[model samples]
Target: MGFQLTADGFAKTIDALKEHYLIYAPVLKKGTGRFTDTDIVRYDFVNEASEIELERKSDYAFKEFLTPLSETLLFFTEDQVKAADIPDKPVLIFLRSCDLHAVRRQDDMYLNNGWTPDWFFKRRRDLVKFVLIGCKKSYQNCFCVSMGSNRSEDGYVFSVETDGDGFACDVPDTGFVPFFAAGQAADIKPSYVTKNDFEVRVPDQVPGAILKHALWDEYSSRCIGCGRCNYVCPTCTCYTMQDIFYHENGKVGERRRVAAACMVDGFTNVAGGGEYRKSQGERMRYRVLHKISDHKKRFGENMCIGCGRCDDACPEYISYSNILNKVTDAVENLGKEVQ
Candidate 1:
């Protein structure tokens, strides 16, 4: 059973939730007409229901809200060390089906994979909950349907969709029912796209030998390594830690973990200036394989949710789905040549 509420009732529900949880939702940031007079959509605190930006896909993923881009790990002072204090308030995040799948992939890495889950991630996981923002249509460049992540059967506390002048919601969590105004039970189905124009053909197997293929070199000439793709990706989890000392004490300060990109320079750098993956092509190859094959070898699922934010965020116009097709062709041709 479900409930339907007008726009005002929806706002009242959100306001009611604010008393218990810190609500985060997609929001539109107006532009100054400097570039193309387009509005930038991203996640922000939703104080009112009208602030949620459901019409367009957000340029940034909600991953950072679960795992921050930069966070202080601990503070140290000679003899004593102190752990960083994390926020205690619970968080309720509104996201799409693909993004919900992204949260699962992230959890697989930070929680389920190892014998001991990452403590920081575990803490964040305990404090966060998800709400599905039903997607009725396809977003440009999205390939989640191909990845089988366009719909989520579970993981969200409740699902909501806009219907005419009112909002219809499937509230599995009974606690949320009090917020809705006087309404009768109505069946509400969440919408999902059946197809996407942009398709990715993943090969049955990307042989280890394919890594030596000359095709990857194309990225060396075209890629500038701006690292926008990683920043916008929901599942890119690599990061680097830095230790900072206080100006006065020189011994007391904090250690921080800052997000990093495989495509960025010095990502593979080590002590004595030794570095692996020297070329942009090498970095690109590593990233692509990790998304499609490497992670799946251990976790049995692709790291990419096929949100296509990487395709949209790339300044150099790189298309990840196109690359997958190229790799597929190269692998097939290689198999034929060997036969």
Candidate 2:
């Protein structure tokens, strides 16, 4: 809400922020190399700035920073329960607006959704800062214009952009009071983005409507059920928990939380060895509708940020946005359908 800064001042501002918080940014890696098994672990980049890939959004989103892919919420031994340490060190994450919006949905789920659990609230309230990155162009399969989550100002503590000689730092009004009160209007205007054209505003009862449409079966028939979309999406937060027993210490063990995808094979296997949504068609319907309908109904926003990583992540070109648009066009043409 202050003056827009030149670019050079922006970089210096964030460089200074690194001292107080660890910055996790889009660091580029080689095409072929060792891949970390953990989705939420820190990324390996070739370099910090110019070397980092900015042309396209990263395949992965910044959700891991807020809700870790694997976290030890609590430890229970012989009826005694104790809390585990969630990452308390303040973290600064660089993210695109879509990813940032997805972060808000997660916030709503953990904090705003209902009873904010003490364990989740503790980690979230204390240890995170956001650095919003600007999107200049659409990459392989972006459809951010459709879902309307491509812009934001809610979460970032320090907003920055490239200035002529250095970097521009825009400290929002609230953040400026204590340390930056005396400074002249050093407000920064980060790079701006041109909004995409298409929009997806499905009806309030879209889950029921989508099920009624024949398109669900048509588009999903090609799905091989690899579950790549769920893995790559910035907003997909479902996870499965597993317990391990140590051979040496029979009484001692550890619990692990792994990211889960409804689309994955064997996704529905339970303790009794039962599976739900056994066919690809059913699995596909479950995922697409959940993203476009069920989540929006509860969160008041579509969970898919329209980052398009799902389309890119898919081996089959099953773009969820395509289905959304097709559904809109079909529903609008119901009169023609009767004629």
Best by TM-score: 1
Clashing pairs in 1: none
Give the number of the best model, judged by lDDT. Answer: 1
For 1-339, candidate 1 gives per-residue lDDT tens digits of 588878887788788888898988889889821157877778888788899887688889998777788999889998889989987899999899999999988998888877899888888889998988888898989998988899988888778878888888887777667766544467866777889888888876788888999988999988999898999999988899999998677788999989999999999999999999989999999999999999888888888889999898887889998888898899899899889
Predictions: Cα RMSD each: 1.7, 4.4
- The alpha-carbon deviation from the true structure for residue 12 of candidate 1, after best TM-score superposition, in angstroms, is 0.7
Residue 118 miss distance in model 2 (angstroms): 6.7
Poorly placed runs, candidate 2 (over 4 Å)? 1-15, 32-55, 79-81, 114-118, 163-165, 173-187, 197-201, 207-209, 247-250, 333-339
- lDDT for predicted candidate 2 compared with the true structure: 0.64
Reference-based TM-score of each model: 0.95, 0.81
Total clashes for model 1: 0
Pick out the ten consecutive residues of candidate 2 with the lowest summed lDDT: 38-47
